[model samples]
Target: MRFARTRRDPVEVNLTPLIDVVFLLLIFFMVSTTFETRQALELELPETTSGAAAEVSPVTLVVTAAGVYRLGERELTPAELASALAAEAEQAREHGLVVEADGRASHADVVRVLDQAGLQGIERVRIATTESRTGETISPQAETP
Candidate 1:
């Protein structure tokens, strides 16, 4: 008796499901991820239980109600302030900046100071704020610097 032979088909892998699952995972992560942006300076009042303080005092930049720039105790014009900051930054003190704006200081003045600080290679800049008895922060009033 003669036996008949049958042809066999080659095995193939369908990658559509794998690709779809991968894309789904990508979409899931994209949707689940969180993004935070700091559009302004962050200022937090010192708590009663705050940690130990550093020995070095940060560079102080004061914006008076009259919109004058004071680097430490010395008052400086905008141009002078920039030059002074550049010089100080070259020292590489690794200290941040403390910005204390008067209650009547203008917002523009504060932002300008911040911008200048950034340009002078200052990495950290803080806004000095006061805490009320009610646990609320009181920002300075708006006045042209």
Candidate 2:
């Protein structure tokens, strides 16, 4: 009786399982990935334990009681403030700005600067305020017209 030679099994890495695992991991990450929500600069952000926080970043123009108009540190005029704000806006990823006027500053002072900021097509201008004792910054509300 002649016996047929048995065929040898081919040596191979079965890639189907590995491929399936890789696909599963990919899908899991896609479904589980967390999206970025806030876009503000993570600057040496001024923080207070109890006060509110700004939801967005804007060209912060600081106005002291003495009628000083400043962006970061440099001073500006009303017309120049408008142009400065516009120029600064080019660097901003967001268009919101705040007129950080001191509590002792005149309301008209804040309004004038705000008008300048708005003149450059800036719409979302907010006032910055600090708590009396805590010194934590708070979001200033808009006046009711």
Candidate 3:
């Protein structure tokens, strides 16, 4: 007597569940992530004892120690800066302007930025500064150039 051979079905892996799980994880990560916008320049801002954190502004100008000017993330020449400021003047006046100058940057350079802003009719301008470590306030009249 010969025994009959039994045929079995081929094994298949169901990837639908795996795909669904992966999709859920991706959505979870995307929803939980926080995004922050930061400037490209590296600036060690000057410190002041009475310094206060400033609110975010639509216009931000960065002045480097080498007298380089950056409007937002874009580097601008002194001449180009004037035109750029003119373009953003409306927004700057509405949302205000924040000037972030390096600790070693020249006072003239900072003044130039302020003057440009003044000419644009942006009355609300704030200088960005860090808090002093010594906890002592220095008066502007006490400092000698």
Per-model TM-score on C-alpha atoms: 0.51, 0.55, 0.55
**Each model's total of backbone clashes:** 3, 0, 0
Could you give the candidate ranking by TM-score, starting with the highest? 2, 3, 1
For model 3, the superposed segments whose C-alpha errors exceed 4 Å read 1-52, 132-145
lDDT of 2 at 47: 44
lDDT of each: 0.68, 0.69, 0.74
Give a tens-digit lDDT track for model 2, residues 2-22.
999999999999999999999
Candidate 2: C-alpha lDDT: 0.69
Per-residue accuracy of model 1 over 1-145 as CA lDDT, tens digit each: 9888887888899999999999999999999998786686554544444333233335777899988998877898877877877767754237566677877999988888878877877765656555545544332222122
Quickly count the clashes in candidate 1.
Answer: 3
> Which residue pairs show collisions in model 2?
none
When 2 and 3 are scored with TM-score, the better candidate is: 2
Clashing pairs in 1: 67-145, 103-141, 106-143
Query: Which digits, one per residue and each the tens of the lDDT, describe model 3 over residues 51-115?
Result: 44445777888899999999988898777878989989999888887887788999888878877
